[model samples]
Target: MLTLGPERWGGGVIFDPAGYALTVSYVLLDAEIIQVALRDGRRVPATLIGLDLEPGLGVIKLEGEGPWPAAPLGDSSGVAVGDTTATVGVDADNDLVVAQGSVREVRSFAGYWEYMIDRAFIVAPYNPAFGGSPLVNVRGEVIGITSLRLGDRPVVNLAIPIEYFTATKDELISRGRVMSRRPRPWIGVYVFPGDHGVVVGGVSPVGPARQAGFRRGDTIVRINGEQVGSPEEFYRRLWQTPFGEEITLVVLRESRLHVLKVRSADRYRFFRTTGKPPE
Candidate 1:
């Protein structure tokens, strides 16, 4: 259980037998104290190992003994758009809740709360109660981790593919995160796709964009001289630039294009060293 003052939440599957656990970073965000509850009802303390924001994965080291039951990782690349699966997680009562489902689509999910998830697996018939729930296949192998719950006819859920964990597992284990010499550039603006260009809808209170005099309703036309046609393109282009680098941003404000230079900072760096993580 992760406790931030009085709040508590569950985490992800244990892929390591020696007490290492994998979870989303948001689960441990601003957490003052964290505990790992075992199947035998022993709630022990857990420490933050590392987190990578680019792919959005968190790792933790639970204080426990050896020979734990770990989930088998499945090849998410083989998951199809119609594959049937199941989601298992803890509910509000801390009771186990499991539901069956199938993949509805595989696409890039973006422009919501400044969250960008590429190759997100949208599954139907299962509504996730919390993050870090395992999306398992018929063979009991984990294909993805349930990250979001949206819509409800039969209750659709979103999960991050398991491959993201495997790809960054070693880096997180050793360095506590993706150790890059250069961090990704972040201006801290939440934008959406518009007919003309990428439109800024929300600005982070302490982000570079807000500090640099960016405003809401400003449509972004170009970044670092390249045109941004969509929200995804804008984010992709931003990630391509190095963190802490100065870049040119051309925006259409009041039907006129204005060029502004912004000094970007590392997003993960800002979140880790500063206050609570961005919502």
Candidate 2:
């Protein structure tokens, strides 16, 4: 990740089953490669590991053997919605970054556990780079993996709940795969916060919507022949359709009305990470 500011790049924590070590994962905006400086002032090379896409967490491993201490993984199940939490990571120029926040909401998404927090503050006060940092409880046990901030809002960072790690640990080690749950699909694009009217901010490039000529900036007016004057009406119509079924989308774009047919793709595949596993 590119480190902002004029500060120099530095080391980060690396914990494997064997032990813990410091490695270079963050870099200055102008630096091409990251180099780790040990506690004794010796430098070493590190390699990037796989990044968990949904959670937005990335991992990297060091090359040489050295003394290192590993942090313990905590039980996320014991964490209540209002409990306090802390974040730890290295900031730009190698300084330690820490923050505190309170859990705001705890809920599930797509049958996967998740949580949100409020009043979080970070010191050394910088971005955690690419969401690989860990969020710990008061006891210093990691309960979450830092991810990206929601849109351009940096303060409201998102994290992947540790429950995903706990549930998939054995599976990750045994079969190198996590058990996946699938969502039923219906064709077409959607906009949330329906009461305010739909703003076409995104489009599935190759999904049924795109194939049907749905483009960004197209204001949806109807779904399956039903008037969709608002976001709520659009979502309601989409959900009412059967999974894997074809549907028609009629939208107003550039003052023109166009009709298109869209077929849904498997929701699970859409969220899965792409490319080869981390080295």
Candidate 3:
């Protein structure tokens, strides 16, 4: 079936016998209305079940008849570099478009959007239209889902390892999100790479950072007494704290160090207060 987002058309895989499907969370963001085009030329309305942003996966359900076609999920842990794989995209005629490629590598991928996938596979020579398309091994069992077009010359692409979904399916179905981990603690400060730490590029108007009197152009030196040297390090340390707790932030503003105590909140909660989309 097809997944048409607010302003774009991407595809998703029906991976469960009960009409539950999967796609990237970005396509599902702010998607108040979604329609699915079946292979038999029938369109079905879909409701978003839930989403897990850590790996950028979204679960959607087709409100239709029973026993839809579902693909078998394979063990992604056994997948290795150099293994042949294929991803299915939608063609101009709205038909399944399958492309073949080889897995180039498996590693962590951190996006500039404050997103991080602990594990992702790099595949080569495949179509980028494979967004949210299932990646199947030679056995035809799905191992991953195409996520991005990293490059073109050598055909590098990225896919979210399937195990992320299989392991959290029940949680998504129940809570609309994973509850195994509490939401990350957020101070609501936008940061950039700095000389020895993350520089505060901007502060959210109503978030903890601004409420605590933090200003722009301040360098984050430490979080709760622990020194941080980079943007990644700062985020990693901040997330380790319990949400809604007060912590001291050591920042250097114009070479003068100031200790500011701020109460952290769930990132999603802050978004709600700011009138931003929860996703």
lDDT of 1 by residue, 183-254 (tens): 767888879888888898978776788888889999999998898998888888987887678889999999
Clashing pairs in 2: 8-93, 20-68
How are the candidates ranked when ordered by lDDT, highest leading? 3, 1, 2
* Candidate 1 ranges beyond 4 A from true positions: 1-8, 38-40, 113-117, 151-155, 180-182, 254-256, 273-279
Better of 1 and 3 by lDDT: 3
- RMSD after Cα superposition, model 1: 4.0
Q: For residue 25, what is the lDDT in candidate 3?
A: 77
Error of 1 at 273 (Å): 8.1
Q: In candidate 3, what are the lDDT values of residues 98-199, reduced to their tens digit? A: 889889999987664446677899987767577788888999888998888886576677999999999988988777778787776777787888896778
| Candidate 3 lDDT | 0.79
User: Cα lDDT of all candidates, in order?
Assistant: 0.77, 0.51, 0.79
